[model samples]
Target chain A: MLEKNKNLLDIKKLKVSFFTEEGEIRAVNNVNFSIPNGKIMAVVGESGCGKSVTAYSILRLIQKPGKIMDGEIIFHPADDKPLDILKLGEKSDELYKIRGGKISMIFQEPMTALSPVHTIGNQICEAILIHQDVTKIEARKNAADMLAKVGIPNAKNRLDHYPFEMSGGMRQRVVIAMAMVCHPQLLIADEPTTALDVTIQAQILKLMKDLQKDLNMSILLITHNLGVVAQVADEVAVMYLGRIVERSDVRTIMKNPRHPYTIGLLKSLPSLSMEKTELPSIKGSVPSLTDIPNGCPFHPRCPYYKPKVCDAGNPPDLNAVDDNHDVACFRTSQIQNEIAGKERCRL
Target chain B: MNENIKNITSTPLLQVKGLCKYFPVFSKGFFKKQIGVVKASDNINFNLVTGETLGLVGESGSGKTTTGRAILRAITPTAGEVILNYKNELIDLTKISHKKLKQLRPFMQMIFQDPFSSLNPRMTVQDIIAEPLVIHKMAKGSVLEDRVIQIMKKVGLKPEHKSRYPHAFSGGQRQRIGIARALIMNPALIVCDEAVSALDVSVQAQVINLLSDLQQEFGLTYIFIAHDLSVVKHICDRVAVMYAGKIVELAKTNEIFENPLHPYTKALLSAIPSPDPDKPMNMNISGEVADPGNLPPGCAFAPRCEFCVQQCEQQIPKLKHLADDRYVACHRSWNVEDSP
Candidate 1:
């Protein structure tokens, strides 16, 4: 029932696994989501939840020992026919053009992304030269313009400054400038502002939001901070142990979460609005990938764990709970009934 | 070891006055000429009451960690007095000898941030927790092991996992082991330096709750140092907001959150992105943190503060008592409007 042109990227039954020495680590299992054109979609989760791995699979950036077993990553450009990114050859020019020209990704660490030896101007100009047919001088000018647009003061002189010469916030701004210099259609930002201070983080988030609007680009934002998602994202998907447990608009997901894991996560976050002596914590920590329990990965830490119902059968699928909200819990109906009963008893 | 010492709670458990720690910077040459000094902690003054948690909130390089280390005597301060109430007598930790400090080490312990790196990966959990008891000669072979198990159980770790190395445990479990190590000595004051910042969200909640529970059960005092205001609000009774080696604001937790006076404190509070979609993110202050090596002549935050005036740019402000139990270091605090 979904329209073809509305979604810029669609991930269908994507299954990614890492074959380690011990065994197969199910990094991403049967994940499904879509990034609509010009929309900011956030994938929120804790560590080892496969959110980064799922984002890495979109641009075919998964390295050796990790295989995209089966799935289709369809990309719909404005003027061209839809193409499956996963089916493209590794070294093909089509993939190369799409990698930086049509789609760009920013990593978690800005220091690692930019080379310390090369000047920032050289680094950013290199990105522009590879994707477009521009002269060296033109690329240099474009780099300065992009840097200025990202709120870097004295962008012209900053061209000669190395990555080490700038602060953490400045280096992050340089990374964003490199990612957005080519004006790509889809931007994948993974924990973009996690390393920065709170003031710097606000500036960067505002920069990203402004850039997204100016360029009319779609963003697949991956982060562990729900506050950032609430501030910027339009859609939210909560990931746990390689599966999308819940998906809805940001308001609905934050206000009326259906999954038990989502509820626990919201409750556990310390808020500034109220001071609490004891925060309601989830029972246990996230299990390692190799030692994940069977039948619903979150069941071990879930508070509403039943003996045979939640811990039995295969993991539930992402079923439609409402008109737009989706939840991957078999006990959604039971949990709702229990909540209603509690309300009646209180009344 | 003595039950009578616990009943006396007349005075503050710890008093830090004019604490300053400076590190000399050298020029890049063969001679290594002295260039300048980085005033990491300068004139830090506070009195921590008995069994109360005092939070030290600041950004990176704001000298919160240095202040914590100076109070514990882990690093020698440039000049200051860290007075602690021990055995119904006041003792200055800074003026003590190395051997004397070692004897007093068990009374004050620290829990570092990064649980993965804080614990000894080569040693088992039991050995790590019992090393304190062994060094102090408090217990022998079996008794030491028993004490370790008891503390581990108190911190919510299973006794069966005592023999496992740190590499086998999860992040949250490893943090529990860290807590057990800090709690084994029954220290009167515990310095938690971003103890819960490295954990996941759910695991962070667990550790925060565990810390409060331990504080209540033992009547322990804490100097909680972190940049996460939400966690500080939940756990701290009072908070001291540090900026550029200065205590910009010190107030009760509720007052600091609801009615911050200093410009830096207000900016920090507004900068926090709340986990609610209804609230929009707004940051009026701009620019990066001031450099400690070459701070401005006036207020260090004048370059980034939105409410900057000529006085703020020319003269530094002192931490003055504004109202009931509220201290703020701002030139225009008297004229600044209330929070919107």
Candidate 2:
């Protein structure tokens, strides 16, 4: 019971910023969340909402001009001491060991993620060889086994094929095999199935779920599709303009979203059941990072935008509204009362 | 309500019969032998009435865009008959000469998928929207600018931003620019091929509402081609499900969603992850989409279908009309419930 309640990773007060000629762009602002051991947590947001930046900060992969301004990423390994990943030096061997051995990432485009010159067998074997002290022949055998585990038919024969020779679905499977070959504790999949067809998307999603359960690994899935979030994620974090607006279990969040941004996102989605003539859309678009709104970033487009209360003060911090459900909204109590009042009226 | 009833009984605006588009592939060498053909559009048949939207949905290589382009004569089809009802006269678009087609271009237009590459970066927004008008000698000078501004405002763009280039606008605003360009000609039929696929969901809803409003105000017909099922369902009146260059099913929007007959259609519908967690998705269909250049014998979906029989492997099923205008192309679609 104690093991089930342990967190694999904890991110607190993370702030990532990009310095450009214009000004400092706050890509990820004070985001806080924790992934429980052997669970799937999804960060849901639209483009330019800084979900990708938060994922990159976990691996310390922020490039030039983009700096991790302030944060504490506490990684709780099963058998080792909890290490603050941000405190590790740029060239520390411990960081290298944790980057790909303890944690690995899978990108959206499989073709670009893989090397075209080398065979897939060599790519997968390289990952295994880097972390494990094994013979070349043993690494090859392990690569073939991993390929077969990912549902690749004729895995042994297909090892010699280059990345370009395989189809999109097959290449994605190879990417997954490479990411999972080292038996990492945490897997960061950034829109992993966005480039594939819907049928193939379903197949890849099912395979990922099966592998996650079998291997006992946590996944930080970053995606914009609400449907995908509902289908896979155990918990969800709604991000808007670098802030974690809401966080809760999947059922609680999807059934009764608290934040106005979350409500707008859910209402905007076109579902199979709801076919109204006019889908009520959130007004305006996501503001540019450089020109973010003063107080709340979502104030410009939020339907419940109050006059000075919402646009003149500092952004609201995340607060608990229910068990394990948190919302960053100043009007949470008022909204709750309004909803209860409407329900009573209906009855 | 009476207007919708009239639209149902009205004559079709466009009729596509036996459309087939094939691109040849040659071997690499001195002796270039014609190896095979990519059947992009294989015997497609559909009809579009006025003030109605017909959705063409499929995967990436399922020939949704090819059918849209072939209908507009953007690419010459290998063999087909595209008959357009122009001013109470039936005119065959494929048989018409190039000069004659140019004159008829004003009635039909197309909105491309990518707003970034589709619009010219060098041209200002005003010029980009007015290029169609300028080419057809419809308007000029201040009159053209006035028309452009009017259409831009209708699509929810500001008049002062007309002189700015596409790079200055957001993705949603750029898509609105693309829509304004397609609507400036006052076209009767617009082939919107994945128009809103590139925008974010919030912007997608805004554009969809704008499109619905435009359709009602102008009485326009749309051949809406896309892969997103939920978006397609919300906007389209009828839907035709395509697979491997062939439409396997064509029916009303609600019928296709509620009572899907084809195995591929069922898999496609089930594959769409619902926003609700209570309804868990169980998509059992396996294997990738079939290669269009080298399709197998009989039904192209036979290899992946769970309900495939020996007869399916031997004979290709013709699209037969089921009850209430629902057409299905499966040998055993009628008995899917019993078999499964």
Candidate 3:
């Protein structure tokens, strides 16, 4: 996968599946990516693209019949040792240390993420106590310090407030506080600002950026919103169906999107610069997981689909378009040529 | 010929004046008594031009949806005057009876946010579209079926899929079904409350294009309620920005986005993460939305406002008219208009 010594978290040939009444649902297929230390790698896709599933598999958090069929998540700790996250037994000492201790995750819905009954302080303190060998008072002091650091007004007074007593933005900050109580090296924020208001979302995003800078932590930001990805992510991994279609540095992905799905998504967005007469929409809805097409899954809706190459068989493995950029499409070079020629894409 | 005649007319379609919807908050104790009122919508006013879209934009709990519901009488408003122009007569929609309102319902319809929950899971697509016609006694049997098919085709649904339920369809298709139901009655006024918020980007675009096309074909007036400012800017001719149960600002689509006067509006505009990475976030509004039950004595946004003054805390600002048909509610609105 990644040159082992350099990557903080390297995922190679990851596959996740969900067992249902009908059959097995292949959710994430052969996905590979690497997160460097102190950088944010955003995994973006529409609903059911398996971005969340891939994140869940990193911590062995897939619930019920859904399981990580095959994968290797190589996490390089600070001391130059690589730990296979997948091999760690569930609820084992090492697994527990890495799950919330070294790598903490924040969810989309802040209100439901935090327990309603417990005070915000108590919840944060619990996380601190679990990982640290500090007394309750010291943990409480650290928790309040984190609350203030996340920009909570009257941080000391807020220590006694329950989850219901706080606003959505406040709850999200509390969740962030909980995640950072132990100062984790990696933070997996799954649409952390989706539930808050746009204004409040601004505050939360800023808060996360500040925290990442201060703590020097790597982040796996999984979201469907491309705008959010562009704003915060250093690099991006675009997923469609169950596979990662493209991965690149954020700037290149935004300016020179090689994938058809990425192009459609960008064109569909309403820009603040000009009023669009019509937003160019990709034809048809996302195909049901059970009824996904063979070969390139997007061929049915792809404007540039070739009969023999795109639809005849499986569309081949991910190929490198540049040193830093990789695209899974069979026509990566052709698309790149077209984009270089300033050819208009069928959005 | 009919379209030409409609174009020649200058009359506004809907007029909302002093609209207010307050939910009573009871004190928690053995003896529960009304302690305060959650002013969901307070003294909101706007006029929708015929064959135009008026976008209602705000944060959650800002009463953007309440304004739409009040006009439709989906929720009975505490106080308001909602005048709807139908045929040659203007009727007070707020004062009408359930019987009279039923008759008027055909011309005014609403599409909800969630496509999944809004549509009945048990009903087939055919029956769902035909329900409106049946309730109004407009069509029956073959005619109803024909009408449903015609509307469905317009919204991009096939005749073969009519037998299937909403559950069988995708989110985008379900939204289309919702749109078809709203348009079946040939509504003059359609209130789309967060219609595309639940759909994916590509699907959202498709639905938006469909809505625009339908608007042009039917000469429909829309009150598009959404928190997304970009979508509002695209579809709406004018916009009313709500905050703390009050319409803090109203202006033309371009004017609202380009030259926002209200502090809250400015903050919201800046908050939208630009897809272009070069453009960084410029505004930071401290704290959350103020409690609607107990809004500040001054401007509700005063607590978080950067330019808030003593007047802001002592007295509430009025939605005062400004130049260029713009309206703003702020003590320091003059400063905004003059700023670079």
Candidate 4:
């Protein structure tokens, strides 16, 4: 059952570009998605696919040479009215008020995301005092409690520990505690578990899921692992060359994947059945941003690429394949047939 | 049990017995000396048969990488013996002289985890692949270029890419260049240390396939080390699970996945997110992996193991054969009849 909270974040046609010396590289191209209150939406894609850029664009964290060229990021904060996040400058006091106060982000690399010199407890308390009008003593106690809530053992004792003092898993938990101390309405986690081992990765993922239930905050999870998306995501968006090729419920995308890129990703994963001799991989690499193919960005590696349509012109936006399922492919039927054929033969 | 030992009678290409590597922590004092030792690998024993893949699966700082480096003689081992069977003659690699080791280096090669760092930045792909050949005096002149092109083709690279440097290629293609260099020696055993873990899922499959095909074609054995269980399952014939510095479990790939015996292996397998969205994951393991330097008294995993008992904390479990080819290092393996 879905939660009864209102839509906390609405993003429409978000186009982000980077002014590189080579040329203007389009990192996020006309991406559109929304996160309902307490829901987790996963954006899955390979490297250089703009999943991270989309998350950064929402928090207005895009650095120099990169700008949100067009689109709207309407965030209806829990305590305040709706506001466009893109219009707020980085140094503006309004943005500083909302950056870590209303919306928090957990980066991929814990070592770099955290300050090397500051204690983990101080970092968490800093977040708490920045947003909430809390005293230093209360913030320290609250930070310890938050750390304990994320399952960090001896949290009170380790309050003075630096980032290097803890293991990767513990450091990540500290990061999560800092992000959640503010009780933000929307949390953006970019590849949170990519650097951790499988066991630690599972623990962090479960912590995020459980915290979402208790805190009732929407999450925009950006990752490249389809396995992770299957576990924690309610909705899935497959990105290719900065465009959303498919967006649907986790079940629809996994069970009936329509886009060729998504299908290729699923096929590429090694299964436990141990029956197949060789894993089937997509043919080629992602085209460079400066040398993006004309029509479909995935045509070079797509196995079911049609000659005239996929090569001559761009494919349309996501068309509804089912009630909540949408795909942006002109040859979904043919790709589905190919996937079914492979499944039948394997069976 | 005796018959099982007898079944492994063939001369292994490489055999490591009681291998241990300890790094000494030196302080700047009047008599600067070894203060303490970081026991990276603790009495690890394994045998790699010719033309078979032996996967080494472990978490970070588990000594899996150290074990690979010790086998290649890249780092000096504090104690132990490494025997290599070259052309039906047993050669003790541990006691060999430095000059002789250099002569013997051509037959053994390693593929590093990151392709970007492994390749030379200033050299072309052709030069990188042919460096081993030139150093070993195997080929020169146009023959070296032809051989480099040939090996590149074998690894799914075009001949035209030989002149380009490693920076010009993608991660997958750069890994292919690393593979070409490793295979150029026609090494009997190749140690792949997290070789494909740095690649994309789709690109990982391609490199794995190329490795397997090369293995079949050249009768090459591999000590494939990785942290990903699924990738290890696909490429390895037998797998070893490591914790801290000890191998906790070793079994056939199918047996290890189907009937995992060790508690740590069970937790690891259960933690891997299955692609089936309808199936709810059994993600219930608690506590983080303990630091290697400050491990528990007996079993390194006893602190995090849910099935730990008093005996587990007092006595270190020895790796023992349980079934036909399965080996597990856990005192509670007999108590837990089946793994869920």
Please tell me which predicted candidate would have the highest lDDT against the true structure.
2
lDDT (Cα, tens digit) per residue for candidate 4, span B294-314? 677788899888888999999
- Which consecutive 10 residues in model 2 chain B have the weakest lDDT in total? B1-10
- For model 4, the local distance difference test gives 0.88
lDDT of 1 by residue, B1-340 (tens): 1133245435778989999999999999799999999999999999887778899999888999999999998999999999999977899999999999999999999999999899988999999999998888999888888888899899999999999999999898998998899999999999999999989998999999999989889988899999999999999988999999989999989999998888888889888877888999877878998889889999999999878889999999999987866899998887886534
Docking class of 1: high
Which whole-number lDDT from 0 to 100 does residue A309 have in model 2?
79
lDDT of 2 by residue, B132-237 (tens): 9999999998899889999999999999999999999889999999999999999999999999998888889998999889998998899999999999999998
* Per-residue lDDT value at B40 in model 2: 89
CA lDDT scores, all candidates in order:
0.91, 0.92, 0.89, 0.88
Colliding pairs, model 3: none
Residue range A1-347, candidate 4, lDDT tens digits: 33333778888999999999999999999998888777999999989999999999987888889988999998887666688888887789888877887888999999999999998888888888888898999999999999999999888988999999888998999999999888888899999999998999999999999999998888999999988999999999999989999999999889888888888899999877665388899988887877889788888888888788887766467788889888988787777787789999999
Model 4 segments beyond 4 Å from truth?
A1-5, A337-347, B1-9, B26-33, B338-340
- Tell me how many residue pairs clash in candidate 1: 0
Candidate 3 lDDT over residue span A214-304, tens digit each? 8888999999888888899999999998899989999988988889888888899877786748778899999988877888998898878
Q: Which residue pairs clash within candidate 4? A: none
Global fold similarity of model 1 (TM-score): 0.97
- Of the two candidates 1 and 3, the one with more favorable lDDT, higher being better, is 1
User: What's the DockQ for every one of the candidates?
Assistant: 0.80, 0.83, 0.81, 0.75
The CA-based lDDT of model 1 is what?
Answer: 0.91
Which candidate leads in DockQ? 2
